[model samples]
Target: MPDPVLLVLDTAPSPRLGRLTGRVDVRHADASSLAGLLPAADVLLVWDAASDAVRAAWPGPGRRPGWVHTAGVRVDRVLCPELAASDTVLTNARGVFERPVAEYVAGLVLAFAKDLPGAPELRGRARHREVQQVAGARAVVVGAGPVGREITRLLHGLGVRVALVGRTARRTIHGAADLDRLAARADWVIAAVPLTDATRGMFDRRFFGLLQPSARFISVGPVACVVRSGLQDALERRWFAGAALDVSEGEPPGPDGPSRDVPGLLLSPYPSGATVGWRDRLGEQFVALYEQWARGEPLPNVVDKERGYVPSADLPGGAGPDPGTGPRVNGSAAPPG
Candidate 1:
């Protein structure tokens, strides 16, 4: 029997797969070549998590890979109707990013609370101003998956009172039903949910309007969850104290992009989950999962295609299934939950 073909959607500084040598027939493809190669492969590895090539080419005529895996936590880039409805199993790199993203959120919370961004200006003017304390502050963290749980744990250590919200109300976690109420009273509102049909544009005008004016909003999840214009309006109108985002809608916004002019807004190019050696970690993770698949064992991090994320129930410390907020695409409208 021929070795099963493993097709890699290539990216710069490609994943080191030396260990798989002589065990499988490895192939490579760029966006332009992926469709032509899909029919011949038994497994697909999406190395470039940010590329939309998978979604674009997945529907083409072919017998798709039996299994597909992305090196990113979120599956939005690779999801399409055809793939979702197909029999292929989808997996993601989940565990690798949880701790890094949680730590990044903790750092952002501290920075905002202590007014760390203003330190340079204060030094220049030789002025002194009191900063807020993170202790005793109230926070509503949306998402109950591994990433969300990690954020909740770290925030608890900082003495912050965190309301961890999941899809449904559980023993210690709040449900999507309580989001508005919790957010309205929170000192910080953090979005950590995946991008799904329900959460795509959940943080829009109405949602922002529910926040306390002194509260700060931070998104560590898919950027499409936020409506750019809605957030800009809220910041301009002082509906909230400030906001920070780790991800951007498409490419990182340019210097002249609309986000640049938005007051009290901080933007980073989706680095929350990217610690040093993250790529290597991703590569190593894929190899491990691939081995499991080859042995016919159940693979972890299997994404719930219809829901667009790995169900929290499948993860250690997962709060539960995440019932998303509302259904809306980016910049569109959805009825209030």
Candidate 2:
């Protein structure tokens, strides 16, 4: 039998897969050429985690690779009904991004608190602003995954009181039921949750309305549920202090683009996970996983395809099986357990 074929959805700064060059039939394809290469492959590595190529071209059931791995934690880009229902084992780069993303959130909190970015821009116009102290701020971080935990850890290090919200309540973590209560008391609201059906539009009008007027909202991941018009309306009415979005609904405009026109809205092309030497780390991580795959060992970071993320139970410090907030997975609430 020939070597197992490895197909990669290539992007700029391609993963350095030299470690697998002689061991497998490694193939590379851009979005335009991906579908043509899916059938014969044994494994598919989604190197371009941000691209939707896989979602558009996932060959159904028997036609796809036996395993598919996304190089990022969120599998939203590649998740489709056909693939989710298939036997394919889906995995992600869970640990690789956690700390970097956490650091990004911390940096943003500091920048906002100290008025660093705003001060510089204001200084250009001979304006000076008072900076707030971060030592006593309170934060509510949605999503208790590795990324969320890391964010909580770093925020705590900075003396910020953090309340973590997961799908279910666990020791020291709040469930969805408590989000509104926590949001109303928080000074910072950070969204680090995965994009799923339940969480897709979670930060809607009602969610935003629950926040304190002095709170700053930061979305470190997809802004799936944050309706643009709702946010605009909130800003018009000065509902909250300000908002920052690393990811948006549509293609983000280029530098100095029209997205800057929105008052109290700060947008940055998603770079939370692109810290120094991150690519090298990603390449090393893939190589390690590739070795495990070659040895037929259980792969880590296996995503719960149905949930569109690595289930909480699979995470290192995650909550138990989702209690579905109100109680049962079914629509009925669990009897006062």
Candidate 3:
């Protein structure tokens, strides 16, 4: 058999992909080039999950790859009818980002709760202040994916009351309808949802208006979830305390991104997952998946195509084992890919 070919659909640094060269064939393609090159590869790593290229170019005249993996956790940007119905397997780098992102959100919560952003001025003064308890504060976390669950656990550890909202109503989680109640009462509103037709632009003026004036909204999902004008207007009028966003529909701000000069807002350049050990972890995940493939075993974290991703039923926490062992696929049931 020929060497396995993996097509990467994002702007990957040259050095980052050097390791895959010797074991698996690696090819790079952007959104514009995906259609012409997809048919030849055995796997596709969607580094840019938001790219519509795959969906636009899909339903080609022939067979597609055996498996597809997204670098990002959310599948809203990549899945469409053609890819969803195909038997070709799909997966995501589920655990790769959960903790780092959770940590980031925790930090943001801490910063807001402790008033750390206001520290610079206070440090010069001799006056002291009262520190508030982040513990026991109510946090309404939207989205029940692996990322949301991890965030929930982390928040619980921080003494925050967390309410998880998924597509369905569950014993432990609330459904979409309950979101308004949670948001209205929450001290912190964290949006960690996957982008779906139902979720796009869901955080509009009305959504922001529903929040208590003291609430803070932090978005960790795609940009479209919160409309630009809505959020900006909220900040402009102090409708809400502030927002910290790690993902955006239009990054680079001026290019249709949120171009606001709103006070109390904190933003980053999508650095939530850019941690020191991230690269090694990525390599580790792929290594474990490759091991399973070489042994003719099933994979972990398979994407559902129709549903965007399939969490491995084999996982104890729905995210598999710890990160150190490269995704913990050392058991039966072939692991989910």
Candidate 4:
């Protein structure tokens, strides 16, 4: 019953929840301030799932909620020794973000290809140079998750041949063994991989060295995917073309900082999936999932604590997290075909 489903979530930016008035018992509380309220709810809506609070306080005195859902992508914050071992059925807003983020990656690739962000001011006639075309560029999208796959599909739409890599080798998808070879030939290296123990700081020197001087790197996942030191090396040496990151090892790149001084790096405060309809879709996801949960139906987009996410069952529903590259953050963007 909606009454038992304590919607213990941070307030959202969507007007869509205006319709869910008396159907559910919604308790709005910030993560830090949820000391006394969590135990009463049967299900807690962890809208801000990235917070340490979810993991810090769990199974509260044998009164924790039976189910918990996060609004964003990447459950690195959600899964841990205690939480994963519990009977709580963990699910995420997987279908909400894949395409929107794919669209964002496409935009960044186009921007870099054309130098749209920091172009040499077209007005002044002091220096007129030739503009380059992006038609024949090679783009490598890391991670074979939904988000990465979506990025690959979008790049392919632009005529860029994309090679996909996943954890295990399979038909049509490359495994870790093939990454370096793929990176070597790419004109654009997109980091759409997840943040697992195997992938943290995975974007180090060797990966950067593989890129051509003309290749750009775009990250739409956790910052930890790209080591800060390695990125600095590539920028300084111009080892590759440039980079546009939606996620970073250290975000809000310190004012008057290295990212600002870097020649070709275009850094923003991680806004890849901060678009319209995002919050509404999150609320919509909750509404739909609750419908299924109440009916005792098996929940879709379940998170596998061991592997982090349940593998994709069909073409549309596996391992999608938004960084929601903002709405949902990373992982899911558009499902990889």
Model 3 lDDT tens row, 114-166: 88888887857666677678987888988766667677777877888888776
Best by TM-score: 1
Per-residue accuracy of model 4 over 1-337 as CA lDDT, tens digit each:
2365465567453455555567767677676666567777777777765565777667544777788888777777777677788888888877667787888888888877666775667676545555567777776677776677667666776777677777655655666788888889887888877677778888888878888988888878877677877888888898987887774322456652335667777765545675776777888888788878877899888887777764564545323322323112123222221
Ranking by TM-score: 1, 2, 4, 3
Model 2's lDDT to the true fold? 0.76
The TM-score of candidate 2 is: 0.88
> Residue 100 lDDT in model 1?
88
Q: Give the per-residue lDDT digits (tens) of candidate 1, residues 163-282.
A: 888777766667789999999999999898888888888999999999999999998887788888899999999999999888533446764333766889987655778888888999
Local distance difference test, each candidate: 0.81, 0.76, 0.73, 0.70
Give TM-scores for every candidate, taking all chains together and pairing residue i with residue i: 0.90, 0.88, 0.84, 0.85
The segments of candidate 1 whose C-alpha lies over 4 angstroms from its true place after superposition are 59-62, 124-126, 248-250, 255-258, 318-337
Residue-level lDDT tens digits of model 2 in 1-337: 7989999886764557887777899888899999989998899988888788888888865667988988777788888888898999999887787787888888888888887777656645755556788877889888777777778777877888788787777665777788889999999999888877777767877778888898998887776646666776777678998888775323455442225567888776557787787777877888888899899999888887877777655454322223432111222111000
What's the CA RMSD for each of the models?
Answer: 5.8, 5.7, 5.5, 5.6
Clash pairs of candidate 3? Answer: 90-303, 91-303, 136-159, 223-249, 299-335, 299-336, 299-337, 300-336, 300-337, 302-337
* Decoy 3 TM-score against native: 0.84
The residue pairs found clashing in candidate 1 are: 167-323
